[model samples]
Each structure stands twice: as C-alpha cells, then as structure tokens.
Target: MAKLLVVGAGFAGAVHARELANAGHQVDVIDKRDHIAGNCFDYVHDCGVRIHRYGPHLFHTSNDRVVGWLSQFTGWLPYEHQVVALLDDGRKVPLPVNLDTINAVFGTRLETADDAMSYLASVALPRSPVISAEDHLYSTIGKELTDLFFRPYTKKMWQLDLSEMDAAVVRRLQIRTDRDPRYFRSDTFQALPTDGYTRAFERILDHDRISVRLTTSFSQDDMAGYDACFNSMPIDEFYEFDLGELPYRSIRFHVSHHLAATAEGLATINYTDAGPYTRETWWHALPGHRVHETSNVLRTIEEPCCYRENSLERYYPIKDRDLMYQSLYERYAARAATDDQMFFIGRCGTYQYLDMHQVINQSLVHVSKWIARS
Candidate 1:
C-alpha cells in the first residue's frame, strides 16, 4: 500500500481519492474551502429548502460507467434540466431557440421543423470559418437570434467579447428546430442527486483508508512522504504564475428567500436584457424538495465578474484563445510531464471548461493509467 495526497475535494479529487483508496492505498484529501463538493456543494437553509451554495449544478451525462460509479454513493432523481430566456420585451421563451421559442419571439407561426430551418437559412449570414464563439453562433443560427439571446448574456457571463472567446466555449449550444425545451436532450442520464452534492461527496470520501482535511493548503514540499499527488488547484497558480496568470472568470451569487411558492417555473432563467446578473435560479424547484405556500422559496441571482485572487471563488476558466495563456499552460504542462510525483487534473488544473461527468470520467481514466504504470 502507498500513501497518496489528493488536493481539492471536488469531483476530480474525490473520484481519484476514492478509486485510489479502494485500490489499497492510503489517501489524504485536502481542500482550501471549508466544505466538500467544491462548486457543487449544497446546504439546507433554515427555511427547509436546500440550495446550491455556489450555483445550480445540473448532472446530465451520457457515460454509463461514470453514472454507474457515482450511483453507488447517491441515488438519483429523474430530472431533465430546462432553461428559459427572459427576452428584452419581458417575454419568457424556451432556451436553445426551439420552434416554440422562435414562434413566440418572432411572432411567426412556424408549424414544422422544416419551416423553422427554412426561416433560419433565409436569415443566416454566409458561413464563415468557425473560429471564435461569435463566428460559430452566427454561422449556425444567424446574427438576429444570436443577438437576441446569447450576445448580452454571454458578454455578462464571460466579461469578454464573443469574438475573443474560443469556439469550444459555446460548442455545447444545442440549436434545434424541434419543440424540445430541455437543456440537455442528448444525454442518456439526466438527474440530480437524491440527497445533495455535498452528501454525495461525503459518501465518496467515507472510507477507512481515506482522511479529509478542510481549510488546509498543501504544496510540493508536502509531497515528500506521499507516493503520488493528484492536484486539482489551478496549474498556473501551482507554478506561481511563472509564465503569467491564466485568465478565469468568477461569479458573485446574490441569494434571497421569498415567501411565495414559485418565482420562476423552471430551475433557471437567463436574463437577456442588460443587467448585472446573468441568470436567476429557483432552488425549491430542484430535487428533494416539495413546494409549499408557507415554505420560503430561495432564489439566487448569479452575477459574473472578474476573478480576484484569494477573494472570490473561480468558476469558469476564460476560454480565450489568447496566445500568451495557451503558451503559459503549455509550459506548465510540460513541467508537469517531467514531474513523476505530481499529476494535474480537473477544470482548474487543466484550464478547460468541463461538466461534472467529464471530470469524473477523466479522473477515472487517469487513475487507471496511473495504477497500471505503478
């Protein structure tokens, strides 16, 4: 048995620590935050309502292995996530610009899929090389729809121009002519944890061979006794911003409670109008909660902002194809490749926009390869 160190008790760290511990290794997991589950952490308020402390995290994945592995720790509720956009005119329509959304927004009676596709083709500009997010969206859906929905919301979320962002950032946009209003329609498994994300992580870490340390920080000097170290901290930060700081966008969540039973019908609504906040989420609408008239409903407004060091939580790594950032990440990656004891994993470590399933799958794959090599 080997002693190992896992940093950052998010999905990546928890999954890796669990797998490593099960494989006859003594693992110690550390997180800078006081809680587990990282950004997916949730807590029940005094109002008898459970709200995502960071923001709404919807788990929807197509990978059977990842689902099967996580299912052992927590049961799931059959939940297909949906999103609606509050247009500039105060009209709420289904997101992903479906047939109903088009009809409602444009005041046109497009009855069939063909009608919607034809209308889009007529309005779409000439297809250009899809490089930036702006180009990809304009080529796929056209400028009018992009301007109506994505422009303002994306600008506020990323705090950058669309042209400056990588196309991979908005590659997940599901532009459909059908009537499906679900955000993740292609996913095979779509649900929230039966309990909450924090409990799920606690279950994952509940092993005799595993020890957890919260509000603790670890560095290379702490890896002397450990056989291996799986680091989930930002790669640039780990290297002390040697090449330069990689850009990341953080959020400020304004959570409030209302006596009303329902605020927004769905879980989340993106505001297309100019506002400080990008979107608002209703917490009671999530799983493991029953709506009540007297029960206070929790609403969270997500305001995206520039990331400040040691002040706020970093959520999304800025996906600008900036030459300097790319070069810096490559330099740090090369350095990690040479360090046999240190392994970088997760969104911040790799500086990629990743969903929950992707993080788990990546950790599983990486750990499997590490075990084989060891």
Candidate 2:
C-alpha cells in the first residue's frame, strides 16, 4: 500500500485520509490545531451547550452524495438555520430581505410574493454592467435596504467598501419574496451532526490504515517519506509568498458565558450598525447543542480583521471586483501544478470561499481522480 500524507485534518484532509485509507493506502493526517474538524470544531461548554470554537457553522447542502457519504460517519439533527438583522431602530427583521422584512422596514401590508417582487422592482435601479457588490445590491434590493442592512455589515466583515468587493460575495445572499426565514432556502438538506463536529471527525479518521497527528505543523521538508501528499495549507505559504501575499480576512472571537437561558432571541444576530463587532451567535440556540442542564449559556461575538491580526489564521479569502487577488491566486496555482507528487486541496490551498459541503465534495472528487490514475 502507498503511504499518503493528508494535511490540515479539516473536511478536505479528513475526507482524503478516510477515502485513501479505505482504498488500501496507509494515510497519515496532520493538523496544526490541537483538535480536528478545522473551523467546524465544537466542544461542550461548562454549561452543557456545544460552542463552535471558530464560529457557527451550519451544514446545508443540496448534494445527496455528500449527505450519504457523511451519514456513514455521523447521524444528523435536522436544523434549518435562521438569522435576523438587528436594525439601528432596535427592529429585528428576517435576513435575505424576505416579504416580512420588507413590510417591517417599509410599513407595507403586502400579502403575496408578487406584491413584494413588484415593490422591489419599482425601487430597484437597474445597472447595465453589475460588477461590484454595491452595484449588485443596489440593482436587486435598491439603495435604502442595501444601505440599511448590508453596507455597514459588509464594511465591518470584509473591511472593504461594497464597491470594492466582487459581486459574487453579495450574490450568495438571496432576495426572496416568500417569508422563508431559513438561511439556506435553496439547499435540499440542512442539519447539524447528532453528536458534534468533533465526534464526526473522530469517526471519519478512525480506520486501521489511517493515523492522525494533531498540533503538527506542515512543511515542504516533511514531504520526504510520503509517496503522495494532499495539502490544505495556504498556497502562498506553501510557496513562501515568492509571488507576493494573497489577502485573507480572519475573525477575532470574543466568547463569554452568561447566566441566562438565551443570549440572543435567535441563534444568530447580524449587527447592521457601524460597530466594531459584525455578528453574535448564541450556542444554546442551535438544535441538539444544549447537552447540559444548566441555565448558563455561551455567546460568541465576532470581529473581522486581517488574517495577520489573528496570528495568520486565514478564514475568508478576499476577492475584489477587479479580480486582482484571483489573478495572484492563479499564479500560485500554476506553480503548485509543477509538483506532481503534491496536490493543494482546501479553501486556503485553492484560495476560494467554499462551504463545508463544497470542501468535502472537492476532496472526494480529487481523491477519486487520483485513485483512478494510480
């Protein structure tokens, strides 16, 4: 059997390690963090609530294959995530700017989906070439709602003006006329792992042919023994920034334990004001998270900053309207292609924004292709 090395121990690495091990390969998985599950890592708080260490990660995917594969490792608890934007006026409206959100903001008594669509169309200022996030938002939801809800939040989360960001960033959010409070309306399935993300990772990595090492940093020199390496380290870091740096946004999490039953009325609250904080999540609000029987709850407040500010912990890769960062990533990707024995495989490796399911799906496809060629 070939000896393979999988770096990061996140969804991408875990999936690769598991798949290769099952294919009769000896796999060794390594992660810089002490724990597995990457950003989806969660632990039971003292109060019995499961707190997501990095931030809240809601698993929602339309791919049945992904769901089926993950189901083999962990059972799921049905959870459709909901978010509300706390307006400056202390009014909480459903996010994605739905029918109720429009009525709440504009004091309109519109009943049907057509009424909401008509109202938005009347106010929307159509742009011929929508390139920037600001242009897309203005054209879809108009200036009033865009400025009220997105402008402040975007500025804080990305540390960039809406006009400077790529349209794809804002395009992820849907403007629905229906009063569907669910965050991932288009996804066919949405849920959390029955036990926890960490538990699921534990199950995934538990194999006779697989071994895992945590708190282990990866280096190019470590690639000596392994026949093949699936790397999830930042592409720029792997190349030591020979082609300059690729910008990424990271979050500073301020977690606190409160003696309350619930911190926020909803699981998550997006701050629409121009504050240092972007959003806050209450751990107890998530389904199947309240494993303990205590009145205390865990609340995590997030503040976005440059990746360098957060000890170089890269989270979201920055994308600009001019595709400047994308162009730089392409250069690094081209260089990565030169190494036949190594493959870059995760969000940082690929330099793109990917959801949990997308990361899992990517690794699945990558490993399957490699197996076929081998």
Each prediction's RMSD over C-alphas, in Å, is 2.0, 1.5
* lDDT by residue for model 2 (1-374), tens: 89999999999999999999999999999999999999989999878899999999999999999999999999999999999999888989999789999999999998999999999998898886998888998999899999988889888987788888878888888888999998888899999999999999999999999999999999878888889999999999988899999999999999998876446657999888898998899888899888987888888999999999999989999877677889999998988799889899999999998999999999899999999888
Candidate 2 TM-score over all chains jointly: 0.96
Give the lDDT of residue 161 in candidate 1: 74
119: Cα error in model 2, Å = 1.8
The Cα local distance difference test for each model comes to 0.86, 0.91
Query: Model 1, 228-326: lDDT tens per residue?
Result: 899999998898887788887888889988865446567889888867788899888877754233457889998888888426467777655666666
Q: Which 10 successive residues of model 1 have the least lDDT summed?
A: 287-296
Determine which window of 10 residues in candidate 2 has minimal summed lDDT: 257-266
TM-score for each candidate, following the candidate numbering: 0.94, 0.96
Q: C-alpha displacement of 90 in model 2, angstroms?
A: 1.6
- Model 2 residue runs over 4 Å out of place are 127-131, 166-168
Clashes of each: 0, 0
